[model samples]
Target: MTQFSKNIVSVSLWITVVILFGSLCNGGKILVVPVEGSHWVNMDILIKALHGQGHSIDVIRTYNSWFVKENSTYYKSITIPNTKGMDEEFVDDMLFKMINYERGKSQLSAVQLYSYVFKAIHKTHEMICQLITNIFESAEILKTLKEKQYDLMLTDPSWGAGILLAHELKLPMVYNVRWTATGEGHFDVAPSPMSYIPITGSGNTDKMNFFQRVKNAFFYLLMDIQNSRFNLPLYQTFCDKYFHPPVSFYELLQGADIWLMRVDFVFEFPRPTMPNIIYIGGFQCKPAKALPHDLEDFMQGSGEHGVIIMSLGSFISALPDDFTEEIATAFARLPQKVIWRYTGKRPSTLGNNTLLVDWMPQTDLLGHPKTKVFVAHGGTNGVQEALYHGIPVVGIPFFFDQYDNLLRLQERGGAKILSISTLNKNTLHAAIQEVINEPSYRLSMQRLSHLHRDKPVKPLDNALFWIEFVMRHKGAAHLRTESYKLPWYSYYSVDVAVTLFAVVLIFTLSIFLTVRYMCVKCCSRKRKTE
Candidate 1:
């Protein structure tokens, strides 16, 4: 045969092999229902990774989605039209109220604050429930979704809408979870001891005194009440209407095949975990890429003192004018150059050393050699990225789980937490200076980074393996625990404990009665003889 013919035949064989291999790895369809804002940021990373693996992804987004765009190269979008969704305005309003309350500028009492939060959560959940209701009621959307025949449903369980959809379609479910509808995801599927495992909003660490433990218990109770009163009832209404044989929303949430938990023990306190819960924390983080020309020049200008980067995550672009002034004044006192991500009015106290921008390349800046300390809002993505890059943090937490996330780093000696209520120029500057000047903070964080990085496979790769494993096996039922199906009493063994106690009591009572009868007979005979 001619050399040209041989080359053609060899190339054809290689192409055929490649096609077969791709077919074997591909052809799995995933229906993703993700939460908005930072949760969407995490979900987007996973979606892109999944698409690279040749899986077809269909994402569900509300018409008012703040981040999940209608158009994307990696995934097809399924937009639901909802007039009232959790948009930026809603978040900003909440933040404003929360800040006012925290700073003692509002007339809201503690009770009022609790009431406001409850109402806000209730309203949000009601909207989500309605959105899910719309999906179910729409015959065309349901038909299209059912026709897609997705292999699995991958979702963030921060909202329970995805859980409802997964159950409705009878598809295996996987969670990209840190928080669930009720609280943190671990509490649902794992053994979370209230004695040491601190509740989300509680400022206590794993080590707690008696009073701290009491506070933790109270926080847990408050969360449970919120779940029962605010979150569940709204979703339960839908459950009653649509489900056959009736299943609680919590049940559907706990019955997922896999939970790709977004935190590892390196960042999280040591707590009990279940078999199916995979820690894929820092999966969204990567080695630093080249910064834009302008950013690189700024980094270079920082010189030996290094650069300090600050961001308040995706949601809060601007704080109150007074708060910004306080922060800017603090930045002025620092020797290191500052890159502050702000959209507020320029603070008059701003110094020549500080640079203000509407946005920043956050992860890349953290990864830079010249980067010294991170001034962050303590969002999970920012926290994980800082840990991934071995950078210490000066955390200024606002609302939600941000405080708890920062507290974890503080407990680990990698970060310092400053309260927004008490944050002034002096406090902010002190916190930043302490983190910068102290070598221990950087050492502790670098140690954590080493531990986080010391693994056989990358976290993203591990997550993908488990995701595809579910698709391959139809579902990971074997790894899933049956404890979720058990009632609360049964799960805690309360029934068994009660039963055993009753049996022991009955046995002891019978013996005592028999002995008493004998004693009475003997006494009667002795009296007659006398």
Candidate 2:
């Protein structure tokens, strides 16, 4: 062939190859509306993973979010006006006060917390409505979403606004959350029997005694009542104001295509799960990256004694100074090195054996050979990571699911739980030593880690597949339980139970009346004979 012809042919071949590759990718446009704060970390993994598969992903999040990458991005970010605004100081303040409130005054009882939360629902609903209003008021933004023609929505249930957006846009949505699923919550798409599925914050276990079960049941009913009285009305009002021909929030929730729960059987007790609830636990976690030179050197320097990594995540990083000092004093007495993620004033009691930083690569440190144990606030992300790395924990849980997760870890024999309210240097030191000294803690963690890893497909891959599966099928409506369509009475079988009760009552009444008549007849016969 002539040289010019050869060059043209090669160019054509390259073009054909590129076209074929693009066709094979078969990417779709995906929209992700993450709940604010560090939750973006979990959203980041799925976003990047889907982006890697050549899908176009767009996110609507809080302004000045840490997840906002500057340039050369696989996804586009749209900042929306939120209650917290650009300054994160308020968030830190709230978390600090919350933790202190629980830790100082003792952890609030389930009823107290529920009542408090119930009272706060209206404010929360208003905040969420404001966030959604900001987006809806902008014709350009709504127009853009319409123009993009997104195939599916991956929503954070914590935010509570994404479902509304999905409904407004007439798109199928998948709910994802890190919170433990309490059956009493609005997202009761499946049956969570109060018998085994412990109440989210009741501090009850799967194996509950009679009194504990009673407490669990009370908490469960209390939440449902709270939701019906407070949350449902607020959501209905929001929907009515925004969307035409009002829809209840529960209706929107039940219409969800699937639920991607960040729960694992390794930490949670085996409970019946619905077809639509997918277990993508640890999807946020990745293979540990190489630690920074300073951290690496610090771990290596620990030698035989090893190191313990402590972090309360972004939300609770700013712990009270005095509170942290108590922890620091305990760390000082330990033979092992301690790396604590502290944003507060450096503790004066900090020991020579300890290192403090504003942030540390948690998973990386946990995965390190020189790392012995993790002392954390028992956040779900931290708990999952510790389990994944087979590192036992000294859990000082403060609030929410942390307490429940710590209880599960303790039951599993992979952790030692300490009450944050009563925390002192001595208790902290003792708990830390117990986890470290107990060989069973490490062994139990290793066994669970093995089970976690022994899955048919990697969690990340499984997550990615299910996400795309929803896109391909438009919506996984078939996967939804028939219970979603049933009324409350039918869903709980209250009607069936009542009918059975009535039947038994009628039968017993008939037998009693017949025996009474027989006795009367016998008496009458005896009197006539006399």
Q: Write the per-residue lDDT of candidate 1 for residues 190-296, one digit (tens) a residue.
A: 99998989999888899999999999999999999889876888888899999999988878888999999999999999999989999999999999999999999
Candidate 1: clashing pairs of residues: none
How displaced is residue 138 in candidate 2, in Å? 2.9
Q: Tens-digit lDDT track for model 2 on 238-329?
A: 78888777676776767778788787788778887777778888877666889989889999999899998888776664677888889999
Number of clashes in model 1? 0
Estimate the TM-score of every prediction: 0.96, 0.87
Candidate 2 error regions (>4 Å): 1-20, 23-25, 64-72, 82-90, 98-122, 180-187, 496-530
> Candidate 1 — what's its lDDT?
0.92
List CA RMSD, all candidates: 1.9, 4.3
Q: Rate the local accuracy (lDDT) of all candidates.
A: 0.92, 0.78
